[model samples]
Target: MKTRNPLPIVRLAVAIAAAIGSCLPLARCAAEPAVRPPNVLVFLVDDLGYMDIGANNPDCFYETPHIDAFADSAMRFTDGYAANPVCSPTRYSLMTGRYPSRVDATNFFSGKRAGKFRPAPLNDKMPLEEMTLAEMLKTKGYATCFAGKWHLGPDEEYYPQNQGFDVNYGGWTRGGPYTGKRYFSPFENPQLQPDSPPGDHLPDRLARDTAQFIDSHRDQPFLACLSFYSVHTPLMGRPDLVEKYEAKASRIVGEEFAREEQVLGDKPRRVRILQKHAVYAAMVEAMDEAVGKVLQQLDDSGVRDNTIVVFTSDNGGLSTSEGSPTSNLPLRGGKGWVYEGGIREPWIIRYPGITQAGAVESTPICSVDLLPTVAASVGYELQHDVDGVDIGPLLHGESLADRDLFWHYPHYSNQGGIPSGAIRHGDFKLIERYEDGRVHLYNLSDDIGEQNDLASEQPEKVDQLRDRLHAWYQRVDAKFLQAKPDGPEPWRP
Candidate 1:
């Protein structure tokens, strides 16, 4: 019950967790009173890249064969994460399981540039007294919808149907698909209408309007969410997938850019460690053919065994900057550099008959742990304290007690990221650098390409993760970077 004011008791805990309709372990629904709860869906791909999928880079050059056959029926997550590295603070910590730096919302919604200081005061939006995980699954009966890029508010009262979404395609307040011919179609997104045709393809017209909103809400519990302003940036594709990735980027070959050590301005930023981008691999195979056209409309509405789904990405992959397109090789710094290739993502999840299919699980989890792990696999509780957990027992293989994952941006990252903050804990991570507090640590099970810094060989694990990342920046009241009135005063804890 420790919410910073949980929207005045969040519709009375969403009418008593929907009048106590319990049992939902992904809709197996225990005793099955004629079963019903699952149908969630989720997708969410912009800027994609935890090695752009082939089940996390089987030499990924960007053809995610239907997200690697839905990551072989989903569990996958070799350390997923994205509670911010870009895109509207990891879509406001995946619609508020909390931690978009509590509320400064860290960065990317009306981004406010500034470097040596000046970015901490940028609220931008996502507030409407905050209850959203599609307004607590619309009082638990679900039927939500929402299609693409909702850059978490700045107008229209806070789009995505005022933050609960009963239906809102192309969620607005700008963040790309910047209208008409932007990704194709006459998509002049005023909540994305013009319903395709006129050169269709805005990720197959938002995956055929989210597979006709999961075949008109398959028979009840829908959530939908689709969110894919394709591989991001105006990097248009689909001229036959840019001529099949320009003949597979003309038979690939080595050395694509290098010089990275400059964390934001003073120049030195190259870093596209080579994923031959032909219009971002034709916008990552037309957003994996719109996620295999919404997983073939959840197997033609047989509800794909009740439907839980949940893929990832909201940040990472725009290798170094706008035209850098895609390459997060060995994962260092990409999208905006809170690095592990800017918040390593592409996690899967599935949940059909309780998860385990291709079950992978390295256990890092984030994106504010997808609203308390799909609102506790659908029974939907979330009464308060959310920094993220309940990985639904790591999708059934089980085990989840250790914790510690943090990030804050404090601005300056139109890519070429600089103001930073990070922490990882278990395999050690650290980071810091908000102008010059200067720290780096690594270890990520032996440097997951953070290029081995270990902050001067682990000075007591960088003062125990910089004192638990400055006590989680005073427990999420974390805004930072400020001087510049005539400048000369960064680094504040």
Candidate 2:
């Protein structure tokens, strides 16, 4: 008999050993699980009004097809509001999941414009000790990135990187894109490099950077915050787009586009009775286009199904002043007042498999609720105190327990708003002017414009709301404007 080859026996033995190693329960494998955590994208727009989007206002002069389409597939919060009626404080609430009053960030930072009452000692920078939404998400292994306006603090240490973001594109202290060359290339922003081609728009550049981040982190969970500085001040748009809107405006009937004046506080504020501003309309369309680009990138990457998208604004539109670009018609004050128009925002959220598509929730929600909602969506538990309640159930078509929403603005607004505090419980709202102790009460369900003041008629209701508001102020240790030792003159910047 021929001798069996020992080499063949050795090869078979090695193959068997390798198979066993591969099948071992404790051994690591080359292939990972197909499932991954959902990515989060927050599209934050600055100075966008409640009625600007077609989804919210069918009569809007500006076209926002992309936003309206997104709303069709998302849950729209009809009564959504910013934490404060300004940029920095509302942004603080978004990042911390707490009322801005709790941290003494009650107004736009560095707002030196004084009024009859001295603006409550302003906290110019967001406190570093407070845990931000990004920091909490990072603990759960989410790659955090921020691109856009970050007016939370005044220094570099208070920027996005220091606030828990792994990467920051153009976040800085300035609320608007007033740096570099305004909204074009060669930006003077210290955090962002001027790498785009000449004459490149800031919003488009921001969207591109954000899309690149999403592309690079497709395989992992990420939080991409795209905050647009468009439609704010220094209203500028592409020449072609401005012409397009101007032509559209010219076609409208004379009665359709008219200007009106309303006496707010002690001054006559000119309100844009209609949305006919050509430059403003162009800015809005450009912003919508940028949003479309980002959403398209998400779809092209094949990760749209596994992403959670949120669209909102820092505050109401600029109507009373600063070009008086847009109208918040039925909502009362804009930007810095305590009226419905000032704090109300467009809140749209899309979470695949969780939120019901094309649903509407009229329950009032605030920016403070964003953090807790995002944390719960990812199955993470928060360990610290939060003023916002988790509205996850609301997304699934379940009702949340009724609660109150509050706002405190002790400084005068550039848009001609007085120092005021407000509280909303159910359909009734109360506003307290700080200069004097005068209170105004309105039944929002009956008078959404806040034109009818029922405080004098309903004394008991006013007393009840005033007491509760004061009690809350004590609970949060809210700061207030102090009386000037000497009779103070009307404050001007």
Using lDDT as the measure, which candidate wins?
2
Give per-model TM-scores: 0.33, 0.90
Q: What are the runs in model 2 whose C-alpha is more than 4 Å off? A: 1-35, 254-265, 488-493
- How far does residue 55 in candidate 1 sit from its true spot (Å)? 24
lDDT of 2 by residue, 72-118 (tens): 99999999999998999999999999999887888888786765556
Clashes of 2: 1
Query: Residue by residue across 53-113, what tens digits does model 1's lDDT show?
Result: 7888898887879888888887888898898888887888888888888888778878787
lDDT of 2: 0.88
Residue pair clashes in candidate 2: 180-188
Local distance difference test, candidate 1? 0.83
Report the Cα lDDT for residue 456, model 2. 93
